[model samples]
Target: MGPRFQNNDRARLYREIYEQHGPIAPVVLPGDVPCWLVLGYRELHQITSDPVLFSRDSQLWNRWPEIPADWPLLPMVGKQPSILYTVGERHQRRAALISDALAAVDPFELRSHSERFADRLIDELCGRGSGDLISEYAKVLPALVLAQLYGFSDEAGARLVPSINALVDGGPDALAGRDTVKSAMSTLLASRRAAPAAGVASRLLYHDYARDFSFEEILEDMMVNIVAGHQPTADWIGNSLRLMLTDDRFAASLSGGRHSVAEAMNEVLWEDTPTQNIAGRWTTRDTQLAGRHIAAGDLLMLSFAAANGDPQVRPDRGSFTGGNSAFLSFGHGEHRCPYPAQDIAEGIARTGIEVLLDRLPDVDLAVSPQALVWRPSPFLRGLASLPVRFTPTPKSTAGGSR
Candidate 1:
């Protein structure tokens, strides 16, 4: 029998697979589909980008048992590169709509909003000595950023946060229950119809839908964009914060103002990318990878963490320090994240971390690393709850220190 299925600790399992197989190994998953596990840096890029060998369409995984039609094992993945899942022309068109908006963003404007949200969350954490970063802070930050960007009402944005979180967690109910999100989208669309706001939704309402997309397609595209912007961005903020907290040297560097935390945030993404598993095409013909033969019709699992950690690509750094920045957490090659709208979310989260660190000089994680609970979903990696404590220095004193 092959290795037992490991849940959240994929880094461990991936390492074992690499050591045993020397990069590519024939493995049998519980579903009985034969797969060649690709772990090396070069192999991952080659297989993932080779259109002839692998198809992103899920129709290829037709024989798998765990995947139910209502609950796709991987929803809309590889089917098309529609923004996150798309490739070529479709990818370019969908990405173009949002990319310009991202490019034109004023960093100072985004930083101002992030500061406001961080202040409110800090106030909420005031009297209490500790709190769950995921619920209290990490969760609200992205929704507010996306909502403000899209011109959605505060109430509408707040309502959709949990629903988007559920969608990230993934299940049949989770997939079907996105009606809440649809309702919010419909309301926003209607409101924009009368009085358009200067956000992505409004832009989509006037630009994409009015021209290229049908009314129904506009709704569908908006629904995906809103949640896509919110979920992974939020997850990354939380994960990166936890990582920084565990390594004080890195956190201090960010807070110290010596390095550009804005740029370092990209490295944080490369180090521990929020999303874990990405589904792609099955090879239509026999292919050689890392010197092993992968037969046609075999599915492959792409592990970003494994690729990011590959020594061949990333240089050896001592003890997870704060300065190393070349990580694959942001993804690379054809499917790399577009980071539209100025890569706003990561900037916001970085600002929050910097502000928090500056104010609470003594703040640190309150529990052991092993005790921390990672969300069970294998597709993304993040802490379920990050409890932290800090010395409550007076704002006046904190300001003076800064």
Candidate 2:
């Protein structure tokens, strides 16, 4: 997959891929890396469900010797001690530790943090009346809240936003961004070790299973959690808001309807999920999937966007997917996004959108929907900028505002 895969109408591209090569098609990555792109819903489900056959271990990859040190995709598919590549029983324990740490985050506090950060971000642009929501609000809000949850102070949390964004964007600064994040996480871990705090970092550092994991392992897990949590949540907010503003179906939302907010968010998950494709599962043994022959150790990319739009499952793609939580946007099976993490993401994203609409009731797209641009990254789907205009309202006071 190249930049065009993300930059162009990706839905149409998925359709073309499906028609040409069926559900599982051969494709090349940025470094001319060959892999199977699993586009069928059933095919993807089968692969994710049976992790034993399609392992998560990057070491299982057969092309590692040919992969150069500086390969751009290395950061993604590179063999690391992180949970993303972990397999078997050890992976299950790691997943549980992460889930428990995240699950401890109070839902009430989570929503409060979301609203507080949402308000702070909107406060910066409410008076301007015209601002890019992606930069001014959606992009920064989730990181700010998540950083605090992970034990960063307000200033440090604010500082983490740019680095997180750059890292997720996978641009020239991605490596540097990764380094900065690692350093910040290390410092946080050290600080938490010295003085226990009420946050996910402290929980992870002192969990019953903490002693079972090494410092580097725990640190890698934290980095994975933070990076994975921030960007996709941010994109969820951006993409959902874009849908509400552009789609006539959600026009009622702009005028103070709360019900449509959830609807639009769910719809985005099915149609324009932030995470379009994942680097993916490696075949443990040669097997036939969707009638395609795959050799042992072959790489298979999961196309969630295509799977959610699979013609066999969603024959009427245009119909409203009301309360249909069957979408594979979050993956399936053991390695899927943990339920607790999904709850946190939904809380952050939903609250962000709700607060923005409540604050700027008349907010409308500043540019034509057709003119809006998407970030040029194959892994994530989100707006480069969501420029919107609303009637200028007086800034809110710390106590209360009109």
Model 2 residue 167 CA deviation (Å) reads 1.5
What would the per-residue lDDT of candidate 2 be over residues 251-369, giving only the tens digit for each residue? 99899898988999999999999999998999999998888889999999899999999888988887999889899999999999999999999999988898888889999998898
Superposing every Cα of model 1 onto the true structure, what RMSD results?
4.1
lDDT tens string, model 1, 170-225? 75557554777777777877888789877777777666524665555666767766
Write down the lDDT of every candidate, Cα atoms only.
0.64, 0.89
Query: Which one wins on TM-score?
Result: 2
**Candidate 2 structure lDDT:** 0.89
TM-score to native of every candidate shown: 0.83, 0.97
Q: Report RMSD (Å) for each prediction in the order shown.
A: 4.1, 1.7
